[model samples]
Target chain A: MIPATLNVYVGLSALLFAVGLLGVLLRRNTLVIYMCLELMLVASTLAFVAFSRFNGSMDGNVFVFFILTVAAAEVAAGLAIIVALFRKRLTVQVDQLDGLKH
Target chain B: MFPAIFTFLVLFTAVCAAGVIVCRNTVNAAMCLLLCLVGVAGLFVCLEAYLLAFLLLLVYAGAVVTLFLFIVMLIDVRGGAPRARNPLATVAGIIAAALVVGGLASFWVRGHLAAPAASATPALGASLKAYAYPLFTAYLLPVQVLGFLLLVAMIGVVVLSRKPDPGPKP
Candidate 1:
């Protein structure tokens, strides 16, 4: 019965979100930021699932499944792009990735 | 009994999340992210959304994070300890994190939690029906469109990663 409380779920999701945010802010490595982005995605998914549980609906679960699929395809493509950029630049620092400079 | 599982899962997730951030090595951080994903999947199961949880394991844990690991392996990541010259940033980060968590906990502890309505049982069933009906009928367009998006992204990635054309003329 207590597990059904929305506040508990939201709090945990919020904590995860904060952790991901901190990682994004504090880390200079591009790969670490990418990983933090994944963590953020997971936090959002958790929020969706928790909301679905409270609403007594399964739509959130189905949506999360689709999100997972999208995330998979995304990573495959995103990582390929990251690798390609890294090969050309030799450094994955975000600061150094400005190709539009004159 | 359930409370204990919930606490354990939350603690596990928090630890992994911290690990992902605090670890200096990018590869280790990626691995920690995988651990956090697994913990989140466990939470999905706890929420009784078995299907979502399994897909999370198969797709996110199995495929996506592994792809990340492969990319990390392919790159020549610089080694040596990360510089710790910025103590002020570190202190500010920890204080901000603590304040946010503490405030949320206080709000939750104030007993504003809502009890489920009597009709909640049927609502779950209704939601399933709602999901199924539209999933097969009215909402199929976006679903198919998402598939197309993935296909395009995949093709674009392959093209981007391919070697440049060898033709002499531009």
Candidate 2:
């Protein structure tokens, strides 16, 4: 049973990672890309929870809590940066924002 | 019992994740992400980490993802409607998906996974004691720093989202 649960958990996480990767590659909108990034983070959180359970330690859960904290901070700051960038450029298309490209 | 529940949760998460990627509208994608987070929390439950699972739903799905949706909706920018389908990327996604499924099959076949065992400490308070020692002693500084970082992020968001100065300085 634990084996099956872990398999499902890992499988789900992999699916999530793959979906996020696909979104990153296929989507040009920055906001959608940001959502994809969040999906990827959630996938990692799932993996952490699963492993922590597999080990029978609370450490994984605690680590996931920290990950959540970091994710919150990251999204807040990232969205702010994105907002500022949008203000300056009026567009959120990743391909259009080539100013950073050398 | 656990396997059935876990499989259901995994399927739920997989579908939501697929929705997030395949949806045409940004709002729908954000909603899909919310569903994905909830499914992750459900997986947490199967792992016997009930506290972490609920917290996952509350902190992530309730707060962070909603905030993300708000920002996505507020923004005026738009693009990437996925006009004509690209067969190449679609094929690549399918192959990647299949490989992942194969990895799961291999893991299941190994039969080396361990079940939840009896622990010396079972209660949440005991668990907290175990958690807090390391968190307060070894991880104290990083945790405090993260709090400050969150504070700064909040203030930065408020500042950035504020209206521009109305009058020019003399």
The sequence of per-residue lDDT tens digits that candidate 2 reaches over residues B28-59 is 88888888888887776666677777778888
**Candidate 1: residue pairs that collide:** none
Q: What is the lDDT of residue B78 in candidate 2?
A: 60
Candidate 2 chain B: worst 10 consecutive residues by lDDT?
B117-126
CAPRI-style docking class of model 1 based on DockQ: medium
Give me the overall lDDT of model 1. Answer: 0.77
Best DockQ among the predictions, by candidate number: 1
Give the runs in model 2 whose Cα sits over 4 Å from its true position: A1-3, B77-129, B162-170
TM-score of 2: 0.80
Cα-based RMSD of the predictions, in order? 3.6, 3.9
- Residue B61, candidate 1: C-alpha displacement in angstroms: 0.3
iRMSD per prediction, in order: 3.2, 3.6
